[model samples]
Target: MELLSAVPFVGGALGAIVPFLVVLGIVVFVHEYGHYIVGRWCGIDAEVFSVGFGPKLVGWTDRRGTHWQIAALPLGGYVRFVGDMDPASAGKADDGDLTPEQRKHAFHNARLWRRAATVAAGPMFNFILSFVIFAALALAVGRASNAPVIGELRPELAGQVDLRPGDRILAVAGQPVETFGEIIAAFVRANGAEVEVEVERDGEKLAVPVSYRLASRIDYVNPGMPASRAGLVAGDVIVAIDGQPVASFYDLQLVTAAKPAGQEIVIDVTRDGELMTFRFMPDMVERPHPVTGETQPLPTIGIRAIGLGGIDPTLEPRGLGEALESGFAQTTRIVTGTINYVGDLIFANADPGQLGGPIRIAQISGEKAEEGLMSFVYLIAIISTSIGLLNLFPIPVLDGGHLMFYAAEALRGRPVGNAAIRVGTMIGLSLVLLLMVFATYNDLARL
Candidate 1:
């Protein structure tokens, strides 16, 4: 902590890089292991299992003669199968010099199905890793209880509310609510106005007045946004903006939205009972719509809503089966959303600036690590799912590209020619490098 304070930029860089390496390293290892194990199962021996590319930083040859190594670069990894010209398996190695036993166990000599499975396994394993982590998280966090009972409330209240913890919410705005969802709907119907909340307390039913909108407590702060740059963090309560008193998050949003981009504004916040002031010029930012993937430019100091209106719901522990189901659903949602965003990018409907590369990922990783262990782990699952999906894109030099070749071979009943394979590999490598450069540019622009 002292070192970070002494040299802020250097410390921040280290913080970001360490977590990024940990996350990418784990994902890459899992992906490569999937290829190695499946290849071995299909009578194809691996010559090397590398966690990165370029010269070996550290390595050891196992009993099976597979050189397991961590290479100099930390960007990506590969599994080099026996009788492969390179780690990418773009062409065949010299098999004439191999012993009879070695020749039979060569990857190129394996059955077509075996080869396809080996290439596909890398992505498949990535999905499996994400699934397991998501499932475990679901199990750990459990599910929110359906009953309309307030388990807890935020320590700081923006305004007076008659509602209290342990109150069993019976109705909202004179409308009976059987579940929490209905209560939320009733609040929405109130539309940022005060509403009557009927609650049962100490065996007595009573009416309490509550605000429809939540207090202006920061729930989430985007890492590179104006709020974060100005040193605002989650849990800080916005007390006022430009000397105008602010109560609800809605008010904060409305004020921020109305301010012109680059207009300087003062924000007063309460953190741990101490009032602090911040001044910054909020920038106009573009982000993809949650459901649409189209770019939407919104004016703001970036902060996300808490979504619960200052009330905490009760949570119920989930069984393994239920947890797994939730995990699968969550993973599927991420995969679909990513695909949609990519589709939008291809159609030019999305902002290219939103496309992040390693630097952006590193920034996020560091931020999440600071948030807590669970947040960091959850990020890992998300990145794992993304890596798995990315490798499945039909681009040469990727797992999906290999599978594409295998499919073509299946159709033609002959392997793709070495010359064609080499050309495709070169094109794929160029595309990947270009993409990295573009994404890095985006990251630098944000900085």
Candidate 2:
């Protein structure tokens, strides 16, 4: 693996494609299995359960006569049930010689509710998988405590400050702080200057003067972005931009924004106690506002701060219930945020160019994997949630579309006409294909 990184294109492709396949395969399998299991419970016999499309690479028939297979393509998967015309199960099979007993297990012959439930199960399982992953991650990492306590100081702060882990911060400068937010606000007010911090350490209160402007230290480097392309990495503290000293992350942001787009700028950073300089042109792109979901053109070097006031938060022990609750909230937030973004895009309030495809996802997966296992897992949870929510959109050729047909059947006392279903499916397929093409174009443009 180390040697592979020395190769030009081969190294990057391997790094990205492997992680991408792993994430996609797991998500697709979970989704398809959802349909398979639910269809089985509904007395429907699955003829084939596949984790991909195209030619079969490997397969085995189970005792129930269901062929479980992995296919050549890894993009998506499907469950072909009995009485399905094809793998997509878009239509019923015309097998005249089928026994009545066999017909009873046919998916198309199943009750309307059963079919709907089976279709809905795919997206449902995706959401559940995301929730489980998020909850597990929270349990593993623990949650940040509410108090303004020091968990661990940044390594750069070593010897410069006497703050220790488990120390409860009482005040910054002269302002007393009761919560973590207050502590951050106090530091921000200090404007990156050295301030006296009062802390309760080992049952004794002590005042320690410390510089609270470590937010300039990069916590994340966005893959394929200006900073990453220029060889900037996390833990590198950006000290100056274009010869102007930057004392905080906010200052760095200001300098970047003030610089003209596409203009080459010099960035001085300190990494492992050594100063280094990098020159790069910042990208001007339409990015979604963090709070509003509205698009605005912004100049960014693509570095991120992981925490407020440069504090490495101490993780507080979390119970199972709390972890699950946090997971639910996180999943809910992503769903709503995505919905808002889609709505904005449709209304021309958001940037459609920001829509990404497989390539972008692969790049992100590779970058996060390089960061750490937990970061990669977190990305998986996010992508899983997105996939689940997307499948729920009421469009043809999706889980939502099938549900729409079921609703019509329930309302009209019969299934929608075959002709109408075929047309809808065609339109849905076209839309899906167009979307993929457009998103891929965007990905290439980014590159």
Q: What is the per-residue lDDT of model 2 for residues 1-447, given as tens digits with 9 covering 90 to 100?
A: 000000011224788988988888888888888999999999999989988777999999999999999988777888988888766566676658567877989988899999999998988898999899989998999977767887777666677666787889998888887876566656655666899999998899999987665478898876445575456777889889889998887677667766775467789999889998886656665654332335677677678886544466677778999999989987886787567658756877545665667777777788888878998988888878888777878777877887888899999998787678778878877777788777777667645
Task: Summarize candidate 1's per-residue lDDT along 128-209 as a digit string, tens digits.
Answer: 9989998999999888786898766766544556777778999888888887656655664465788888999999999888
Q: Enumerate clash totals for all models, in the order shown.
A: 0, 0
Error of 2 at 112 (Å): 0.6
Model 1, residue 369: distance off in Å is: 1.7
Instruction: Estimate the lDDT of model 1.
Output: 0.76
Quote the lDDT for 103 in model 1: 93
Alpha carbon lDDT of residue 176, candidate 1? 86
Tell me the lDDT of model 1 at 262: 48
Q: Candidate 2, which ten residues in sequence have the lowest lDDT sum?
A: 1-10
Model 2 residue 201 CA deviation in Å: 3.7
Which pairs clash (backbone N, Cα, C closer than 3 Å) in model 2?
A: none
